[model samples]
Target: MKLRLIIIFVILAVPNAWAGSQSQAEPQHEPAEIIKFAKDVEKYAASKGARAFIIARMGRPEKDLPDGIMFTHTAIAVYSNITLNSGEVLQGYAIHNLYQTAGSPDKSELVVDYPVDFFWGAHELKAGIVIPDTQLQQKLIALIAAGNDQALHNPKYSVIANPFNSQFQNCTEYTLDLINAAIYDTLDIARLKANAAAHFSPQRVNTSRVKLMFGSMLMDDVTTKDHKGKVYTTTFTTIGKYLQKNQLADEFLTLNSKGEIQSL
Candidate 1:
């Protein structure tokens, strides 16, 4: 009975231990500080004439993240004309994301939010910015504008989703699928998976087999069935590396709260 109780405790706490994509209940930093950092990220992207770019945020503390994991959540930001509640039309960036459903981490939904809202629950005021080549950027903007982004979404959420398959998807994997759809000019899931397997290299999840096994058994969002051998998944850094390796990115960088820029 005692061993069973200890197992229950570990199962209940596995989600927090693995740290999947989820929004925070409260702001980690001051509201003003978050807003400023978010705006700074936008300004930096806009200054580079990035009509559409991939953005990432740290949903968990950097120290707590396992090795090779950098950011927890990723989305696409497109420059557009935003209409506020006051009927004011402002030119800014709007973020498109695949967020896990609240209270149902196994499911996900496509959400459109702004940079401020994107960073509202961030654990750190750091941003991962990847501006694709101008041609790819135009393609991405056109694809999303044509409503293909939603067409490519798979609502089955997983924390360690295998990029080579469409069985389940995380935010980063969803973003990668969208990018590939634009690049290949097709919404065919099979073809996308093929291309991903051939061209893209995913980041391996650095955790023990025992923990993963237990997490998969207990957590609805954690699964290893999709992975054939070593557990691997799409991540913000891997996406950047993919774009860079293919010469599809104009700039891949990181922005901090202090307005510092560093290459990824």
Candidate 2:
């Protein structure tokens, strides 16, 4: 029952608009399929001579979300040409994502770590990969190096964040902001927000009013606000659409639990 309630909370926590990892003490192992998918991302980037890619996975399903909307999390993966002491060029990758801290519901941290850690605990092994062009990839690398990505983060996480508003942010929003910054003059947050909303508008999901109220009341970060009127939230779907429309993505892939790849 407790688990059910938690799922309920996560599922209904959003309305429309809105809205990482690492290692430590003991080494944690991700599922075999996820690891394989990560490897595939690295290999694909290297093969295309691409500098960066975006990856998202299907987390556990939320009952409150509309059917067929499955992706729950997204992150950016960047490839670096590591020159070893032997002068051999080895490609190394760093994945970045924003995660909420355990101590406080409102506090979140930007995590930079390995690709393997990015897909940990995914409900299914499925993933969406977006490879941006060389110039855009260079811009993405700059953002990661200068910590400009942090500027785009909104600690106030919401299930359905208003893509047009700056008050809240989620993983997808962070990723979108990075892309926007790289593509346009990201120094101005107002322009970036406007561009993002123009390319992609969040979609609304229909749920019981009681569940919506319960979610807003029970969850510290969840709220109806203007979202109830807008009736939509941004997720991987919106992000994918923006990428596709802009012609920014060099390659896109969908991988299943068995590690099969299909062009999305």
Candidate 3:
């Protein structure tokens, strides 16, 4: 049901490829409210003096999913102190997201981009923010510097990836595993997978059986395991629950389309 919407995100992830098809596809102009929301979010992070932040947004409207689940995607933002060639130090941020490479649609890779660039053309201006403690923030930076961030990725991109198993993974599932790695200071696949499943359970969206069957048939990587005749999939909201359960987030907030901030 949401297959077409997912393809839109894949197109946005690969701007170079999107450019080729821009004429025929008729790219939508980003809303002014969304741009304001992204800018204000960056400002809010700077004011908090956070080392890194977790961000979630409404990717698109998926009616098949359960109600009250507005957020569809998640990513990580890290603040860095860079020293230029001229010996000048500057503060900057980089957002990391899991995306399917344009050249190889079957493969998933980490995409590092500026905050505004990351949020460009988001379906909704609303977002949820998470600021980790100083200790965890440093760990996250170290993990990225060591090039260990790639260890948590599962090349196969599955929309209904089972969080308890490592057979396949989705964006939010990968983010949860990365957080688990930083928290334990270990990239052990077994440990990260177990912790993620314990702290975060997949959200059970009441999707129609027919739609679920269609998803399994259309998406080669997607599967609807017959576990007690039920289906489970990870979402941004599930990641929020895990952070709160483990107290991994020091501060959390929600930014709305109206340019208002609400602390969580």
Highest-scoring model, lDDT: 1
lDDT of each: 0.89, 0.67, 0.66
lDDT of 2 by residue, 6-58 (tens): 76765544443122221222223356656776677667567777668887865
The per-prediction CA RMSD against the true structure, in angstroms, equals 1.9, 4.7, 6.4
- Sort all candidates by lDDT, best to worst: 1, 2, 3
Regarding TM-score, does 2 or 3 come out ahead?
2
- Mark the 10 consecutive residues where model 3 has the least summed lDDT: 15-24
| All candidates in order of TM-score, best leading | 1, 2, 3
Kindly report the root-mean-square deviation of model 3 from the true structure over all alpha carbons.
Answer: 6.4
* lDDT comparison, 1 vs 2, better candidate: 1
lDDT of 1 by residue, 93-150 (tens): 9999998999998999998999988998888899999999999999999999999999
Clashes of 1: 0
In model 1, which runs have C-alpha deviations exceeding 4 angstroms? 1-20
lDDT for position 55 in model 2 = 78
Clash count in backbone of candidate 2: 11
